[model samples]
Target: MDPLLAKIEYWILDCVENEYSYLWEIRSVIEQRLVDVDKAKLDEYLCMGLSSVLTQGYVQAFAGIDFRGEEQLVPGFSISTSFIEQHKKAWQAGVEVDQDIRFLISDTGFEHYRQGCPPEYFS
Candidate 1:
């Protein structure tokens, strides 16, 4: 992995993990994908896909640390319940972000594999 990409991925995961306690798996997937990101690809994704808020948060988290991007990487976290609620509300509002988040659930209902969230916790 390019050093710049690795650093960026770590900052992303670190920020996201603060908000979404159950996203270690997702972070791992992102890290793997980042290994292929060169400077040009990183810039392209930033311009198109990723929000600048993420980078800002990372910079804030590590104040005084020099990062690759000109934008400050202020660390940020999403409120877990609020994060879930935003998706729920978006789905309800007929947003195409995805099918109703509620519909994504299986009958079991979020069996907790993580220590922070116990089984059937969302309800």
Candidate 2:
């Protein structure tokens, strides 16, 4: 993995561990840690990293929670890898992700993270 991507992946895993899985919250922590990075560049890298994990089934995306704090349904659109890619493009074009999406590390993701994210995934 790229050094920045590696850091982002670890930070994301950490966030999931801490139960702070919302995109905004994860971004805030990463942005704070990478203060010297340009915002645009950071967003680009973040999108890429997120897309990769989601596509690989290492992370699951959820949306559309009801007022009762129950997960009504997983937003089918947001769960796709293409959605994440499009989101990254939109963000780069200055259009923000307007959905209320949250992420969770899948069991595979936890195993991968615990295994230090082996070099195969790095490629």
- Per-model clash counts, in order, read 13, 1
Against the true structure, what is each candidate's TM-score?
0.22, 0.66
Per-candidate RMSD, Å: 17.9, 6.1
Candidate 2 lDDT trough over 10 residues, lowest sum? 71-80
Name the top TM-score candidate. Answer: 2
For each candidate in the order shown, give its overall lDDT on alpha carbons: 0.33, 0.64
In model 1, state the lDDT of residue 51: 31
The digit string of per-residue lDDT tens for model 2 on 32-121 reads 877898976666656766666777766777664432365433533233445445655765598754455677777888887888854553
Q: Specify the poorest-scoring 10-residue window by lDDT in model 1.
A: 98-107
Q: Which residue pairs does candidate 2 place in steric collision?
A: 1-122
